[model samples]
Target: MPIAPKHLKFDDGSVTIIGVDCATQSSKVGLALGSMSKGLLTIDKAMKVGKSGSIANVVSSWIRENSTTKTLIAMDSPLGWPIKLGEELIGHTAGSSLSTEAHQMFRRRTDFFIKEQANKQSLDVGADRIARTAHAALRLIDEIKEQVGMSIPLAWNSELRHPISVIEVYPAVTLKSCRLLSATSYKKESNGAREQIVDGLSEFMTLPEADKQSIIDDDDILDAVACVLAGSHFINNESVGPATTEDSALAEKEGWIWARMPR
Candidate 1:
């Protein structure tokens, strides 16, 4: 079944938004925090994860500092494991019943949904390119949940109306929707590819050229910008790809990746 995107409602320009590109290694995570005021969006904070830095500390500190502001965090990570996979991991599945069909049966609805909408697919948390990152992300999620409380998923935020919210993000999918670059390109070590991405992003938004060039070699920073934009998109009611009816149960386990935001 195809997953439909969720529409979120927010008070006019009142929330501080944050975006994080979660990485298994702390040094690679990227963060962008900002807000929209009078219809003009501005990013006031940007950081590339350093070897000595901790993702938990950065997030916690940001929340603490912004205590008075309503907040929305858009993170690039899998917050939960697939339900069937979770059962198998916890020994809840019959040994004889741990079949491929069973795994397929519980595949995350959002993954298929994103593929259909963005022509991009997310890695399965159980076993995929992002598996390790997903594990690391879930740990951060637990810590943040304790500090900030359970976050409202994008799909549910419209009705629930929480002061703080979090939604899964995919930069490649987001970039594709924005038409800045193809999902498969611009994520490479080569200078040519990096320059292409940097140039593409520059065209979409007003960025400090010098600062933008400094992070051009690192796609992580570009993704951080993408995540931050996704957060802004959510706050602006421009985000798409939320959990559908069939996805509620799976989204509770495997988090939904909000796709289809224009720049």
Candidate 2:
């Protein structure tokens, strides 16, 4: 993959941090705008996003309905998807990886880049890509403004006056955080793990008042979204996990193995 331009502007509008999780039937969103005084992230708005991804109207309707503009969007989709879109929005070829194939290409190039960078500077090649992306875009942003409609950031966060961040979270994080150890364990017991779907829905509805009994079964999409959210949170500074370090090496006579590379 080609490297980004050295002197490119990434920020153009008031940025906002938006966290998205395509929950159950709805896309649950959590947005944090940089405080005017602090310029740090904070939860200022939220919503349950839904979309009909037809064509050019894939993401704009939701943005229009929500009146979300002048804010950079941060999604949890693999960087390749939105990277291409971001480039296209500005009418250019994205320098980042292009597709799943590009990700595989990254695998081939990782060693080269790692050796080159490590030889030059003794820095860890496995440093957080998302955070680095966020920071670098903020520092060197220079893109001609073109109308874009997608759930990804066209402009970097730093350029915005009141920047907002959008992160895609995952539900498994929520379930795990809720202490749902094993799905089977929860199902056979009397606790509340079985209620995860409802619990998540309740949250989606702001724990709606005068609740009528409704049925909920699985949480596939919800869990996926929650995972996105969790992954996003971990990417952002909001989640600083001091989780214990444990080494579990099924280290076979293999080429390589990286168990839980630090976030």
Candidate 3:
């Protein structure tokens, strides 16, 4: 069967609500513009590459394919980096994540931790998937900001819902944020099929500007799209928890961090 179908109208929207996610092994893109729901998101594709150049390509392709969504891309990474890096890339870190470091936000949200668990079984911290995923998003955030001048959430404010406009999400440091983005989905072992998503995000982040030659993963974009949809969900629903308070995270059935949200 096919990994990603052509397209399905999920929700009806004046603006095409879209979300994007990045993972270690694969990438996911979601679209929530016009259908039955507020926003419709779905996985676009997945790929296998190891750096920024390849990930950007994946994103560009997806955007081109779904360019009609009046596209507003929601990404699941830090979008910006440290001062030194941010200034160079014209990006800054999202400030809200500090409330919860691993707050679940998008594919990267659960993805980072899921792979953290898998890291023990796959790439180990020395080559851990979570860090790698975060790094991949961070790198992409830098590149996208440099070229597109986007990504990076502002301070959290309830009035605006997420304190950021268009780009919505808590900073990566917030407690179990209610998102589904993470770079942990892909793992690098044996046939090296896991890291495919991560590599795809890297390529998409760079895009036509950098032009890196890495494999692509549509799943990364889909996951990022998930994060975006969730962000819009939080804004419209206003139930993502106090835009100013910390979230409640719970461990998995196995006694590990399974999921969390603002309480």
Candidate 1 TM-score versus the reference: 0.79
Model 3 has a clash total of: 86
Poorest 10 consecutive residues of model 3 by lDDT?
A: 250-259
- Tens-place lDDT digits, model 1, residues 1-263: 11111323445445666778888898888887666555555566667758987776677667656655566788898776676665565655455556446445445777777766766667766675678897887777677766655454444453226656788888887776667665456666765766766577655555554467645767787788778767766666666644466677667667777665443
The most accurate candidate by lDDT is 1
lDDT per residue, candidate 3, 43-130, as tens digits?
3332334443455554444444553343344544433222222223344365523332222212222234444532312122122354
- Against the true structure, whose TM-score is highest? 1
lDDT at 247 for candidate 1? 74
Clashes of each: 2, 39, 86
lDDT of model 1, residue 110: 78
- Candidate 1: misplaced stretches above 4 Å? 1-12, 87-97, 102-106, 145-155, 158-160, 202-210, 241-244, 261-263
**Of 1 and 3, the candidate ranking higher by lDDT:** 1
